[model samples]
Target: MSLRWRLNLLIAGLNLGFLLVLAWLLVNNHRESIREEIEAAHRVTVQMLGTAAQTSSVFGPPDTVMVAFLQSVGRVRANEIRLIGTDGRLLFGSPPSEYKAGRTAPAWFAELMRPTLDATVIALPGARVEVVPDPSRAILDAWDRMVLIVLVGIGFVALLHTALLYALRHLLQPTEADARRLVATTRELAQNREVTRLIHAGVEDERKRLARELHDELGQSVTAIRLVAATIERGGALPVSQGAARIDAIAASMYDSVHRIVRELRPAALEQQDLRAALLDMAREWQLHHPAIEFEMHLEGDLADLGEEPTLAVFRSVQEALTNVAKHAAARQVALAVVRGDAGLDVAISDDGRAGAASLGGSGRGLGGMRERIMALGGRLEAGELPDGGFRVAIHVPMPEGAP
Candidate 1:
């Protein structure tokens, strides 16, 4: 069931339980009250008849005087009186009660409320007087009162349930609006991630094209220039040879610069689809350039089969982190670790740098880009200042299904 219906059911159950308990209490109280009322009335009637029986002998013959007295007294409330003669013939009986005379409470209600009381008997000289307790009228009164209370209680509980339902609907309105807004936000975020992933793919494709062009076109052209200069140097003319040597050296330098740019655009290790080898190559190059700083790397698990997208995302994140460390951290030591487990791949790059050095500089954009890249790969990236005066970047990328 929906939450609203579940809440409604719960409230209904509670109200129903309350009504049952209220009815039970009302029945118990009324039953006891009726019992007490009948008992008291019955006691008074018995006493009066017994006293009258004792004094009847003074008036005349006991049975005749008692019958005359009973006729004079007529009906007593909540009690029945009868006189028996010496020959076992009925001499007198109390008249039936006229108060609610023709009506009685339901049989079930009467049985529940009926009190147990002993019939009182008084012996006369030639007969006997019997006073039996009667509680029907009292029970009928209690039943009437209980019916009224139950009707009122049911109405009150129904009204209470209606009010609570209204209040719950009113309270849930804002929650419904918030849920819609959350759904919209989630959709927008997913679209943005898709766009980011497409953009990253396009950029990598462009880089690969540029690297291939520079290597095939510009690199070969530079080699041709070097060959021509070598031919001129073989001529053995001092001035021409010197000029050719300078040209050769410049072409050689330009060739080296082009190769470096191509490597940066698309590393050979990545072209071979080996992320571990790419990371190691990058680290070795970084250490070569920044010989003053200490660089460390640790790799575990099978990095070769992580697919191009995740491998590229991790590679770019580490690359950006290391560049940021070189430019901003000014630290003595840097450590990079990449591990793959059953869940996914994890990469961490940390540097022992000045506190908050990475964030203080223009590193936010780079870090943000790296985070977006990782997120697009169904992963997450976290970069922050470490507690002991350093900076760290951590990235995780989930493995695609059936990946080795």
Candidate 2:
């Protein structure tokens, strides 16, 4: 009715078919073996009868000897032995009469039973013909039993296969439930985090815009006003020299504020050079800020050449890692490695801080943002505190096809 049922049925059918075929093959093989054995035994008996005839003159009357000989052969061989007199009366041995009453042997078996090439037949002193019951009929009967056993085995195997599928479905039900729940939870968490990240990025962009406006528009107005005030102070417009000097001091203060605002708008170094040069400059600035911590950077490969997105992701990842290390890792030395390979690029930032893996978990949102940025660029980011004490971030970015 359902897909699961159909799948189970299909598998069961295949298994049953295999079992049945195997059973038939085994039955056929057994039947052939039995037939060969019976035929061989028949030949041996014929040889013994012939030997008795040849030795009749030396041993005694062959008729009496042959009667006992035929009986012995019948006892030894699986097939029934029959000695037909001239009138067709069986004088020595015969098969069960019930065998004749059973289903008639097929034409093929009957034809095979009709004797072919004569075997070594022993003659009694009085002369007699020896006949044996068809080995084919006996073999067929054994084969029929074998077929029945095989059918039964196949049925058992089919039952086992069906039961196994049923058991697996039942066992996997709970696991399937857990998987669905896990998927749901992951989706919800991702949506919430995505919204939060977008909001944060928007706020940051807005701040940069405002800072640019302040530096460009407001700073220019302030500079113009300061120039006017300096001109007035230089022209001796103010009665007191101290008052004019105060105006100059205020103008200088305004100029410093403009410089600070311009810096806040964006790092000037980033605009002047590419991402590699920019990162190095930022590292130098970070080291200036955190003089106690040692910063080491090694740039290998062609990182300076990359798409805007990938380059930006790398730059931000480095920035975030360093920022995180500064805030969380109370370490002495920091190592930043950027390796660009043919496949893509790798950036690893490690610090010899007191924080280990456990400490990095709740260290804050910087690592999460770094991870998201890398992920959005089709890269992977791994962040954890190193075992030997300190935090480390490893990032991998896969290059586009044919990208060198």
Candidate 3:
């Protein structure tokens, strides 16, 4: 259920799967090696029987020799040597197969050993000799060796299990530590962001109050000054008229300055229009400040019904991004896109500039405010350089229910 346990299980499963594969390969290889060794032993046994056949021929009537040789072979329970004419009567050779009652290996063991032997019959002076494996002693020999190997394999597997357990714990220990560190870092970041959010909210409230005071109080006073100056200019001496005109001009300039302040405090475009118009207005205004930059914008789908927080977050995010590009990127070309999808709104602002440069804003460079604003609105923001070239700022804000 917990992440650490799930991760450990995943890693352990993979390691165990690898061990099982190795065991399968080792078992198959061991089985093959045993089979080859058995074949080699059979060849050696068959060769020995052929040599006895040749040695027995040295005698005039070798039947006695053959009988002695086969009887000796039976005692060893290795190879069966037999002699019989066309009549199928026992002429002169080893005893019957009843000699091997309890001496044989179990049937399962025999089949597993699976000796591949064939009878090599030779023509002699009087009768024929058949050379075939007796198989009891040979199979028992192989079974004993195989059992030793099985026990060793079992011990090896146990050793491997212990080593793997230690190794997994050792290898994953740092990773687990790093994960815990990361979780702590993320928690701290969230707390800091909450504090920043509160600070920004208070600062924004102050900005609104200042803008209102400048607009209502200072603006009314300036308007009254302009009215009095105009009246004085209308019916006065020439010098007084010129002085009043200059006074009226200063009043007008001050009013325009205050209006600009109010507009920056609470963006008028966002107030008067929806997200689409607001974003375009922000981009167009930015372009005015940087006439050298070739800026482009693409707005897709309907975005009018996106509510207060979403619209404000999107507009402010773009506004900040373009400002960064204009001030730092030295970029000649830039593009902005806002897409409305079934999931949410997606915004990307990018510039074709020297990427990875100091000006690309590794220090968060005012984009930190943008990120905090987006995150507070249930959106995500990513700012980095594109692989091919240039820097990009991308944001995705999920659409709430009943959103247009």
lDDT of 1 by residue, 1-404 (tens): 98899999999999999999998898888878877888898889888988998899999998999898999999998888889887888899888888988999999989988888888888889998888888888888888888898899899999999999999988876786799999999999997886676568657865786878777767776776766666676774446766667677767777776777667667998977799998988888889889988998999999996888887888888988898889888899999999999889999999998755424432455776777778878898887888888988888899977898
Candidate 1's error at 2, in angstroms? Answer: 4.6
Query: How do the candidates rank by TM-score, highest first?
Result: 1, 3, 2
Q: Judging by TM-score, tell me the better candidate of 1 and 2.
A: 1
TM-score between candidate 2 and the true structure:
0.43
Candidates in order: C-alpha RMSD to true structure: 14.0, 14.8, 18.7
| Best-to-worst lDDT order | 1, 3, 2
Each prediction's Cα lDDT score? Answer: 0.84, 0.69, 0.72
- Which regions in candidate 2 have their CA more than 4 angstroms from the true location? 1-265, 268-273, 356-359
Q: Which 10-residue window of candidate 1 scores lowest in summed lDDT?
A: 355-364
Number of the top-ranking candidate, with lDDT as the measure? 1
- Best by the TM-score measure: 1
Rate residue 175 of model 1 by lDDT. 85
- The better-scoring model by TM-score among 1 and 3 is 1
Q: How many residue pairs clash in each candidate?
A: 0, 2, 0
Deviation from truth (RMSD, Å), model 2: 14.8
In terms of lDDT, the poorest run of 10 residues in model 2 is 113-122
